[model samples]
Target chain A: MKLGIDAMSGDLGSAIVVEACRSFLSKNKTDELYVVGKKEELLALESYSQVTIIDAQEVLEMTENILAIRRKKESSMVKTMMLAKNDEVDAVLSCGNTGAYYASAMLFLKRLEGIEKSCLMAMLPTYNDRGVALLDVGANSENTAEQLKSFAIMGSVYAKNVRKVSNPKVALLNIGAEHHKGDEVHQETYKLLESMQEINFIGNIEGKEILDGDVDVVVTDGFTGNVALKTIEGVAKVLVKSLKDGFMSSTRTKVGAVMAKPALKQLMNKFDTKAAGGALMIGFVKPVIKAHGSSDAIAFENAMNLAFDMVSSNVVDKMKEGLK
Target chain B: MKLGIDAMSGDLGSAIVVEACRSFLSKNKTDELYVVGKKEELLALESYSQVTIIDAQEVLEMTENILAIRRKKESSMVKTMMLAKNDEVDAVLSCGNTGAYYASAMLFLKRLEGIEKSCLMAMLPTYNDRGVALLDVGANSENTAEQLKSFAIMGSVYAKNVRKVSNPKVALLNIGAEHHKGDEVHQETYKLLESMQEINFIGNIEGKEILDGDVDVVVTDGFTGNVALKTIEGVAKVLVKSLKDGFMSSTRTKVGAVMAKPALKQLMNKFDTKAAGGALMIGFVKPVIKAHGSSDAIAFENAMNLAFDMVSSNVVDKMKEGLK
Candidate 1:
């Protein structure tokens, strides 16, 4: 297996991607990884001799127009995606701006057969000590009922094959759990899911139910998912701040904070971006993983590993089958 | 001003309503308090001697048929709302089932003119050490673009009058802040808001930007708001749990939890539902406060004080002028 890595995409420049690729290459030989970026940056990696380097001089700035994905063929991110598009690589990974990667994935790589729209899938931790694989987190915020049902099918395949959750309970995330609840699109989608036999369709799951581990695959349009994803992040920040303030309110508590630093740091790390790789865009022929732009080496490594597993699992095959 | 409180509502029954009313009567000469519920229950209040008793024989059981709000006219919640409609009371307070309260409010108190939909507004703490007010939390999971605009208007007015901010900044929540970013509805809504000269519309706001305190009013449809709201709740719960677990992980940390107990308790109390009181449904001609179903005495008192402020500030009068 071969993989394409856009080693120029994250907010940390080459530090994260270079180190992650170098560290990851140390452990793996079954996969031939191609690092696509500036030739100078590629040479900086001691692991450059161990793997292939595709010199793409184009720089895709984070704040650049998303259409740059099309305009900049020599761009590392775009070229990396192109490698997978032409089947030169099995997967492509990026820690770049999500919109740019998304643009290139569809514009260059194209969607898999039988998939109407690709979804940005995220693995969100559950309150129940598990994970719910969700779709369209920021890809297609506005969706028809048919598009939603399609998302459910795509999400289920990804969860079962990659996440390895058998029978992967699929649910449409709605405002309410009742079959009759939600907007017109959701209500109609509920009816469609209720009639479908291809996936293990569960009833509507509410946002409050996401972390509850009620469903393995939660489907929603991108807008709600993005807002929800951000809201979760925002609230987490608030709570953590509250906790920090709580721990340092007085002299004794400040001392307590010192004694508890290790454990508290460990807990806070769980919410760190580096621990959870960026979202995955599902329903593509080649596995495409996105590391958070603010990701550290751990996140970049995590994205590569996640992409490795995704490509190996043949999740796309199931998606194609389910699409039919 | 006359206020009717459902004595049977709330987790902690008539005692809170009695105390709040007792406090109200003692402080003001131009006040009438009506305890609307089972007379037998009202008798449980020590301060019951100062209030009028209106018999409402029926009770809408929580977690049961939510439509029971419409079915039982004699129910305590329905009676109180009807009292508000008939001018028998200036406002109605309930700590009962939310669905039941909504049904009664729509059936009896009626919608304010030019206000086709009402919203559940909550004050969320911002990263900047201030609060940002968001509306349509879950009142109507599905809403028209016009209704969303109305929420923005109402939210702005409420923030100005109740929160005492001038020239309140208003923003339409979207997947992106860019023009024409989201689906059909949001694109159109964006145009509509941008054209509304009367509103201090600052353009679109993404979810992560919510707690930045850049905008005073964040308006979105209830479905998304509800989802975001619950997601925030879920994340907060997880973070708090993680913090607690972190503190208890080591023996030294276990001792820290005790030393940190006082400050932690104070911080937790600040985040308590009691401090915030219940969700407030703004846009009524008079203040209609919804105390939490599980509210304790402290929470009930908080709701009552909020209600007093709502009236004293005359949020209705301001809405009447701004909305028109």
Candidate 2:
């Protein structure tokens, strides 16, 4: 399979992309790999004969107006996704400005055969050593009840393919678990989800239920989902900071931190975004994994692993079936 | 000022209420203190001769059906709010079931003169010394854009009065800080909040900005508020559990836990709901504090303190002015 990668974007830039290419190509055979970005940035990963660079003069600098990054066709992220649409590459991976990548995904790659709009999905930190997929964490905000049901179908398929959860339970995130909970859209979505036969539609899940691991996928509009996702991130940051302060408050606590290093590392890794590899914008013609913006070589390699599995999972076909 | 406190409520119902009553009544003189609830429960706080037990025979059990509780007129929580509304008591404080207390408040204490709906007032966890007030965490999921604007006014007044923050910066919670960054109602609310000259309106505050202490009051409809509030709670639980597990995992860590007890205690207190007390329902005619469901005497005492200050500050008068 040929893979297209955006090498100029993200915190680590081309350095990690080169390493990720080296690691993946060394492990398996590929037809061809197209690396997109500025020539200088792409040249860093130019060692492999099978790998080729497509330089775009306009760079989507991370520090620049990231909102305006979508207009730059020369940007590595947009060009790479464009290549995937033209079938120059089988799949696309990006660690770029997420907004730019999302815009280009819609502009070039386009949504799947039946999906009205594609969803940006990330795995949630769950209680049962299992993962839950949360959609539109910062994507579409004002979705219709039908669109929310569609999200359930896409989320179910994505969780099965990526998380390896055979029969994923899907839930709508609402104010409460009761049938009459939430506003008009949510209440209407609740009815639709409850009646849907194709998905493993669980009843409404409260905000607290997201951590319970009771459902394999939690669905909500972008507004609520984005707030929930960031709030969780903010809370995690606060908790981590508090823990760090707790461990360094005095000499005894500092020594305790030394004793608890192993456990602390394990705990950190458990909640870390790295474990999920990267977020996938599914419901496209082919798999697309958006690596974290601050990705290093390890994170890039993990994203590559995710991209590989999506290629083999036939998730697109499953999505088509669910849509049917 | 007269306060009607539910004598039998909360995790340590009578003891904590009695202690808080003992502390509060000893310092502040009021017309009369009415203790409502079971006769036996009220008798526990009889040390203050000025404290009268108004035998409330109908007990609306905590954690029971809220609809049922609303029906019980003679229940302590309901009766207390009724007493406050009828000018029989100055204010009412309950450490009982939060949902039931809110139900009782809405039904009896009622919304402020012009406010559309009363909001659940909470001091969210923050790194700053002064906490930010978040409203409508669970009171009402369905709120109009006007209700949200009113919430901003109510939240701002409470933050200023109860916390004494001068010109508290009030912000509407949305996915992003941009002008058109939200769904329909949010966009409308943003427009109103931005244009309104009645308050110190900050632009949109994202979930992460909340704990950053940039704003003193964050206003949103109950759905998003509850989701954000619960997400923080869930993440905190995850971190605390992992911390405990980390400490007990090995002999070295157990020894370290002993050494780190003081700092760990500090960390625990920071995130502990039992120590943080209860959330107040803003926009009510009478001051009502809704303690966490699992509150201990310490948390209950904290809620009592909030009520004490609410009464002393004559915060209702301030909100009355804002609403009018």
What is candidate 1's fraction of native contacts? 0.65
Q: Give residue A167's lDDT in candidate 1 (0 to 100).
A: 88
RMSD of 2: 1.9
Top DockQ: which candidate number?
2
Instruction: Report the TM-score of candidate 2, chain B only.
Output: 0.93
lDDT of 1 by residue, A12-47 (tens): 987778888878888985678888998888786644
Candidate 2: tens digits of C-alpha lDDT, residues A1-324:
788888878887688888888888888775567888778765656778888889876767665555665577667777888888898887899887777777778777867777887878888667655878898787786788887888899899888876788889999998877889888999999999898887888788877778777799999988888999888888888778877888888998888788777777867877787667888886788888899889888888889888877777878778888898
Pairs that collide, model 1: A141-A222, A141-A223, B10-B95
lDDT of 1 by residue, B173-285 (tens): 88887987877778878887888876889998887777677889898888888887777666767767777888879898888777777767866665664466677787677
- The TM-score obtained by model 2 is 0.96
Worst lDDT 10-window in candidate 1 chain A:
A41-50
Worst 10 residues of 2 chain B by lDDT: B23-32
Cα shift from native, residue A221, model 1 (Å): 0.8
Per prediction, the TM-score for chain B is 0.90, 0.93
